[model samples]
Target: MEEVIVTVLSEVRCHLGEGPAYDVASDTAWWFDILERRLFEARLGKGEAQVHPLPVMASALAYVDDARQLIVAEDGLHVRRVADGHLALHVPIEADNAASRSNDARVHPSGTLWTSTMGRKAQTGAGAIYALHGGVLSRLFGNITIPNAICFSPDGGTGYFSDTHENVLHSVPLDPATGLPVGAPSALYRHHGEGGLDGAVTDAEGLIWCARWGAGCVDAYTPAGERVRTVRVPAKQTSCPVFVGADFGRMLVTSAYEDMDEAARAADPQHGRTFLLDLSARGRPEPRIKLGAI
Candidate 1:
């Protein structure tokens, strides 16, 4: 049970902040306020974050290249130009299902993008997980309430996801070449305490760092599902975590005040604020997503 101190990275509060990502080439960090339909960007160690209002609700993103980004949104996968922030539809996800929106996502070492979709109102069994690679999409899991913790191992041979509603994390063997699962997912860990599993990321040592919603902490576990460390966050609803900085020695965590009442919001004053943590763990650089002819 190790603890680390965190400082506010962005002061702008969000109703539902998630999907923090970092682009090493530009030395910038990006995240989303999902409910607000807004995207935020900040240079590592910069003073403040710049806000961009989006036309749709987007939860996650992957750097396609220096000039483009792949955004996982409510409607579909959008290709966003870096120069002017122009966005064009690359592909539709659950576009016909207006009740569903994108959730947590992460990129595999093989240049595959793994994303999830969830019901707008958190409807039971109204979500699923998908993997997109070379412009093709494949549904890996379905009948999920809240698909999250979408991450992969350093070797890309293991994929991890969690249904927050069930408070259980699952792991599946993946085909590293295609980023597709080769076997059924098995339960890796179940939380019986305060918070549920939200989002997670794997480090260079193959350790999983997961945010615990409503618990105000991030927990680290070995690949064997043994909890090893915990990092306390000021915000209760910690949603996601991403490695940032030039050396990827720092972690950026996003929080939310989505379902908080007035009293709860007041009690958790730091809710919805993104934080930067200095820790000993090192992170692997996020791989650029491979895009085929669209």
Candidate 2:
């Protein structure tokens, strides 16, 4: 593998930074500090970032259109107006359950959104994954401990997800047009390392790039589950990775300082900062989410 240069993209520290997304139309990057209930946005190459306070703990979001966004929050799915940041409840997912909050998520090539929820305390078997399409939310998996790495392949025919607590990555076959699973998921890779899988994204060539939460690195693996490349990150708790830039030539990664103590924080000064990586692999743009009743 070639040398990868990592640089800081934003200095704002997040207690539990997670989701990272890019909107091609506005050339803007967006991420969240889940524990702080805050959202951060900035243009590519822009030094300054705009912070927006959110009402609920939101972990992931998908572009519904140029004017609106669908945000997956602790309470439910919210439609956010891009102009003024006004939010309206669009749909509810476990709104009655106060124990869980939204986690990692991603959109499929067919415009369906896949998201997960987990207990606030990382309680075992307290998480589940769901798929949202045409205004309906369908539960896909349950009894998950810490669901993460929700991503899809370039053609949308395959889906990938991981249970960090289990350290196993699984792959499922899907209907490319609807983003619904056509077959059961099977184990693709099992990690026996320092950290578990956090979040991941699929490249244009169908390779899976995953962030290792406590290991301070992003790894690339072939569809056959072979590790092919690894890029070191400055932060130890790297959480998520998203492709950015006009040509999707660069990747944006998010980290967290949620579970660190003073000593750990001091040792890892860059624990909660965001980073950008220059790599040879390119990514495809995220698909627009389709909302409203079908």
Give TM per candidate: 0.98, 0.98
> Deviation in angstroms for 291 in model 1?
1.3
lDDT of 2 at 223: 88
Query: Candidate 2, residues 1-294: lDDT per residue as tens digits?
Result: 235898888899999998999998888999999999999998876666888999899998899889999898998889999999999998888988899999989999999999999998989999999998877889999999999988998988999999999999999999999999999999999999699998999999999999999989999988889989989889999999999988999999999998899999999999999999998989889898998562
| lDDT score, candidate 2 | 0.91
Tell me the deviation in Å of residue 254 in model 1: 0.2
Q: lDDT tens string, model 1, 57-127?
A: 99999998899999999998999998889999998998889899999899999998899999999999999
lDDT of each: 0.92, 0.91
TM for candidate 2 is 0.98
lDDT value, residue 188 of candidate 2: 96
